[model samples]
Target: MDCIANLASEKAVVIFSKSLCCMSHAITRLFQEQGVSPMVHELDQHPRGKEIEMALKRLGCTPAVPAVFIGGKFLGTANSVMTAHINGSLNKMLKDAGALWL
Candidate 1:
C-alpha cells in the first residue's frame, strides 16, 4: 500500500488502464500526441491489486479500470478525461502535471 502510494506520488501523472478499453487507448494516444509520458499501470497485470483496491477505496470509488491521477489526485473516468480535452482543460492539467511544456 505504502509502495503504491509512493509510486503514485513520485509521478507527475499516472494513468491506470486496461489495455482493451478504447477510451483508455484514446487517452494514451492523446498523451502521446502531446509528448507526455505518463506513468501507466495496467490493473490487469498489477501484482499488488489489493494496493490499488485500497487506493480506490480511499477515493470512494469502486475499482473501475482506467483510473487516472494527476499529481496524485484522482481525476475520474476516461469520459471525464475526454471531456477535459474537449473543454480545453486537459492541456492545462498535463502542463500542471509537468507532462507538457505548453
Candidate 2:
C-alpha cells in the first residue's frame, strides 16, 4: 500500500493492472487516446501481486486490476475512469496531474 502510494506520488498517472484483464487494456487505451502516458504496473507479474490486490481492495478499488491514480490520488474503478472521460472531466484531471501538456 505504501509502495503504491509512493508510486502514485512519483508518476503523473499509474494504472495498477493484470496483464490479461480487458479492463486494464481499456484503461490504458483511454489515457493514450487522451494523449497521456500512463505508467502500468501489471500486478500479476509482480512478486507481491496478491498483496497488492488486497491493498487495493482496502483502498476501495474493486476487481483489483486497472485501479487508477492521478496526481497522487485514487481515481476509482474502471467505470469511474470511463465516466470521467465521458463527462469531459478526465482531461482536466490529466491536465491537473501534469500528465497532459496540451
Candidate 2, residues 1-102, lDDT tens digits: the string is: 898798668789999999999999989998988888898889999898888899999998878878999999999889989999999999899999899988
Off by over 4 Å in 1: 1-4, 50-54, 57-63
Q: After superposition, how far is residue 60 of candidate 1 from its true place, in Å?
A: 4.4
User: Global CA lDDT of candidate 1, please?
Assistant: 0.73
List runs of model 2 lying over 4 Å from the truth.
Answer: none
Scored by lDDT, the top model is 2
**Tens-digit lDDT string for candidate 1 (12-49):** 77777767767667777777787888888776678876
* Residue pairs with backbone atoms closer than 3 Å in model 1 (clashes): none
Displacement of the residue 75 alpha carbon in candidate 2, Å: 0.5
Candidate 2 Cα deviation (angstroms), residue 51: 0.9
Q: Rate the local accuracy (lDDT) of all candidates.
A: 0.73, 0.89
lDDT of 1 at 42: 73
